[model samples]
Target: MMDGGRGQVNVALEVLADLNINIPVCGMVKDDKHKTRGLIYDNIEVPIKSGSQCMHLVTRIQDEVHRFAITYHRTLRDKRTLYSILEEIPKIGEKRRRELLKKFGSIENIKNATYEELLATPAMDGKAAQSIIEYFKQTSEA
Candidate 1:
């Protein structure tokens, strides 16, 4: 079962059909206020009782899927942002950026690290460590 209206459900059904998967596909169609109105199957609108166990289950599933999607996107965005910030530091490339993040866990930790601490990380040398220290110093000042 999917959480959407006719148009969304129809596309999913077509994709499944193309894959030769024969299974009953139903859509939890929502009304104008975004509440589930009925289940659409075989082009039929089957009303579900309000506050019923089935309705509760469908609502929970939809909420869970939305929450998971948001969390996943936020994680990806944070990683991209972190990498971009690291790239601004001279002498730091992809491999060194990865190693620093792996060792320090987060940008905040890397920023707080002492020159000796940054130098101790694998694949990091004096130049890279100094660049990181200087980059954070400049960003903090700005």
Candidate 2:
């Protein structure tokens, strides 16, 4: 299933077909009034009656999926922002960032961690730990 306008739904279907995912795709789209219009299947718009059980189910599903997608995107954005700071430090790539996040849970915890504690994290070395320490110190000072 999908959620978007006609163009978006069509493109998604095409991409799914390209990936060899053989499944029927339907879109939960909204009308000009910002209301749940209905399911768009096989390039046809199937309008659902307002206040019907089917409408309630479709609206609930669409609302839930939208909320989930937004939350997921926000998390990725926050992680990117946090990891971008780490990227500036030498020897800190995707693997090291992941390791640090796994160990400390958040950038604030990593910042507050001691040099020795940083080194104790999996895949961390003395030099990387020192760099992290210095990065936080420099930022805090500035």
Candidate 3:
């Protein structure tokens, strides 16, 4: 995922959602165990329970998405230096913010995006998208 980042993960989620792919996404989320954990999407997290019957289901899914987005069984090891001005915003973090930038292409374009447009990106809820739009407008005026 985009240089082993969550933003790329969210992008994958959106692409799947748009394509109407109905599988749950599971991946290595760095928490206490340092083991394979569930991914976060749309502000909610779908976790993978280990050593359970659900584990098999989760593993099957993780394997499938991996084959689709990536080559074989490996994760994205490196990332290119692709970014926009919006990604520089504070409190945005690497996941949701970069997703917004990539989806909108630029701050100007994102400012042009309606609330529904902003919400199209994964993890961007109504409030966050509106706040981002407001920031874009404020910065444009200043």
Candidate 4:
């Protein structure tokens, strides 16, 4: 059972079909008020009794799915934001950015690192290390 409505269910069905997996897929649909209303399978709506155990379970599942999706998206967004910051450094491309991240774990660590520490990172050169140091310095100043 999916936590979303027709759109999500259809997309999931299509993906499963592509993988040669045939299984019944149903969606726990919400009403206009954003409350779970019923299940939808093959465009048929099966109304769920409000305040019933079934309804409560569906609500729990939907809440958990939404929470998980939000967390995953936030993590991806943070990674992208960090990588873009690294991209701003003149001599830091994908490889050097990756190396810096691997060595320091976070941008805060990289920014706090000394020039020698940055240069010691694998795939990092003196120019790239200097670029990172200068970039962080400028950003901090602004």
Using TM-score, give the best candidate's number. Answer: 4
Ten-residue segment with the worst summed lDDT in candidate 1?
1-10
- TM-score per candidate: 0.79, 0.74, 0.36, 0.82
* Better by lDDT, candidate 4 or 2: 4
Winner by lDDT? 1
Cα lDDT for residue 100, candidate 3 = 75
Candidate 1 backbone collisions, by pair? none
**Model 1: residues >4 Å from true position, as ranges?**
20-24, 120-122
| lDDT (C-alpha) at residue 79 in model 3 | 25
- lDDT computed for candidate 4: 0.91
lDDT of 2: 0.88
lDDT on C-alpha atoms for all candidate structures? 0.92, 0.88, 0.64, 0.91
Better of 2 and 3 by lDDT: 2
Model 1 lDDT per residue over 1-142, tens place: 8887788888998999999988988888888898997899988889988999988888898899999999999999999999999999999999999999999999999999999999999999999999999999999999
For model 2, name the residue pairs that clash: none
In the range 21-113, model 2's lDDT, one tens digit per residue, is: 988888877888978778888888898999999998987888899899999999999988988888898878888999999999999999999
Q: Count the backbone clashes (under 3 Å) in each candidate.
A: 0, 0, 0, 0
Residue 18, candidate 1: alpha-carbon lDDT? 95
lDDT of 1: 0.92
